[model samples]
Target: MKQVDLGGSGLNASAVALGVMRINGLDSDAAAQQVLETAAGNGINFFDNADVYGDGECEKRFGHALKQSNLQRDHIFVQTKVGIRDHAYDFSKQYLLDAVDHSLQRLGLDYVDSLLLHRPDALIEPEQVADAFNTLQNAGKVRQFGVSNMNPNQVELLQHSVQQKLIVNQLQFGIKHTGPIDAGIHVNMSDPRSVDHDGGIIEYSRLHNMTIQAWSPFQYGFFEGVFIDNPKFKQLNDELQKLADKYHVTKNGIAVAWILRHPANMQVILGSMNQGRIAQMAAGANVQLTHQEWYDVYLAAGNNLP
Candidate 1:
């Protein structure tokens, strides 16, 4: 459980944070409390949730579980997303403000540690969003702000009109899906591999001091089944297992280590509802995979070295 500064914010967050998306299905309140206790015991102080996850059930569960726990509110960093409703994205000033308020009520909190725009809204007006963010910041509703599933240009658009700095960009990253790394390695050629798929998000985030949080660290893609132990990803899993054995850790931890090995200072968001799974993944923050082992896992994932 290594702690890292979340962008320029004074608050320090764990390198591996807990994602509460799947906690809505927990059979009992005690079950959810056990998960939270396990995560906190491992020094994971950052808890991520969203207004739309399980239709806001997850957020309410977290708020209740925290209240029952002995842990104080200030000891944790809680983040939730906005701008998404039903099936559409909404970043309009009115929607953004209303969304935060709803999230606050559901979570039973005065202010969110950080509020992120869930995704890019095609009709986004940066100035309108800035006004909402400014008002929220002044009213002590939100301490900081950021975006999720957005590329460089989308972030730049917000920066153009917003006075507050964009401090974090949460993206989907895993060993099986390495498009961000692949696009960078194959840049600038007539070949399709050279095309930028992410709009140079990785570099832009690094350049702007925006922390990149890796969500779904084990998924094949977009909530698809995890690649761990899947026959389709046998080679990659083989290498991961070998490294896990070397480090005396579980294979899941090795999967997390692959992302932690990156120099981007990325944080891993684990969406598991199982407490044991979260503990296994948290161990990766302490296991520094060797340089060779890191690149070996990369090649196993079928990415070209160039």
Candidate 2:
């Protein structure tokens, strides 16, 4: 696996991050451990988790697996999110403090390598969030801090209060979910792609050296379904197959490679639970697509130019 610096934060991990949001479905601790081993063997040292995933069951299973495996706590990178709640979002100081403690308990670790604010809280107090982060850092609870599903303005607003650099902003980005890319290319145009959906977040993140961890890389329309093999995405799949054959990788692998080809420098968070698919996608990180090939797949995803 290719190693990349995470948001110029001096934290480095594989280009691919194995998200454990779905691991709560594993039958046993051993099964969970098997998943960990497979991901680790493929050079994926970074594992992504969230407090609300499976209502915290996913974190519990991940902790159990880590405890049972031979892998040490310090060798791999563990990052988890906080702030999502039952009916709403909470970034209150007390809530964040308690959440980190609970997450550490579930992961059986003293601290997470990185902690992300899961989603933007409409009532977020930057100073309160900063206080929580400073307290956690002083207590050795969280090593680094970041945000998820946040736009440039939101990130800038929050970063204004925190001492730690907001290093990562995980967003929904891929061949199909190209809102961030669309708004950039269609500049000064009248089409929907020029809507500036995210406040030019792609350029914003790149300017700040913030790593954009792309979640749901294979899905379309906000997790409606994966377009990898869906008949509705026949043209896209056909192009993916063509690239896959050209690169000697699977169609999914081509998708992963396509993401890695971007100069914006993103981290791909894979959601698949299949062991073979995980390894195969990780292999794609090693691939570097040409300029023309990259745009070819982009157009194949049904995008239009101005």
Candidate 3:
């Protein structure tokens, strides 16, 4: 797998990351271990997790599985998110500090390579967030920080006070869901795609050197379903299959390739817990699609250049 600088943090990370959100669904410890081993063997060194994933069950399972695997702590980068609570978002200093402690205990690690705010808290106080980050960094609990599902303004609001550089912004991006790309292409046009729903977040990340981690790269309509074989995306599936045959990989691989083909250098976080699917998707890191092929797949997904 190809490695890229994770934003401006100076940490090298794999272009593809294994998201452990679904690890809680594994039937056994050995099964989770196999999945982790497969991912590490296939060149995926970055693992994404969240405090609320499976209600923290996934992190516990991944910790146990990592203990059973041969992969060393220094060989990989582990990241998790916080700020999301049962009823509302909480970014208070006490909550942030407590969240990292619990996550470290569950992951069996001294500190996470990175910690992110899962979602924006409308009542967030940037000073409190900065204090929490300072405490975490000084106490050696979190090495870096970032956010998820946040617009550029939200990031800016937090960055104004946080001492640590916010290095990442995780967002939902895929061929079937192309809001970021849409706003860019349809710029200056009187079209629906010209609406900047994200407050120009994609451009902001690129400008500020903040890495955008693309989560749920295969799903459409906010977890409505994967579009690979879904009849609603027949054209997109057909194009993906054609590219898969050309590259001698699975359609899933082609899907991943399309995401990596972008110049943003964003990491594609795969949430699949199945070992076979993990291997198949990782193969996309090796397949470089041509510009025309990439655009073809984009148009096939019901998007217009405008």
Candidate 2 lDDT by residue in tens digits, 86-194 = 8899999999999999999988889999999998999999999999999999999999999999988899999999999988999999888999999889998988888
**Which model, 1 or 2, shows the larger lDDT?**
2
Give one digit per residue, the lDDT tens place, for model 1 in 116-225: 99989999988899999999999999998999999988898888999988899999998877878778888665566677789888888788889999998898877789
Model 1 clash tally, residue pairs = 0
Query: Which tens-of-lDDT digit does each residue in 1-306 have in candidate 3?
Result: 888799867899989999999999999989999999999999999999999999999999999999999889999999999999989999998998899999999999999999999999999999999999998999888898999999999999899998889999999998888998899899899888899889888889999999999999999989999998999888888999999999999999998999899988889999999888999999999999999999999999998887
**TM-score between model 3 and native:** 0.98
Q: Model 3: residues >4 Å from true position, as ranges?
A: none
| RMSD of each candidate relative to the true structure | 1.2, 0.8, 0.9
What is the TM-score of candidate 1?
0.97
The lDDT, on a scale of 0 to 1, for candidate 2 is 0.92
User: Per-candidate TM vs. native?
Assistant: 0.97, 0.98, 0.98
Model 3 pairs in collision: none
Q: List runs of model 2 lying over 4 Å from the truth.
A: none
Point out where model 1 deviates above 4 Å.
189-192
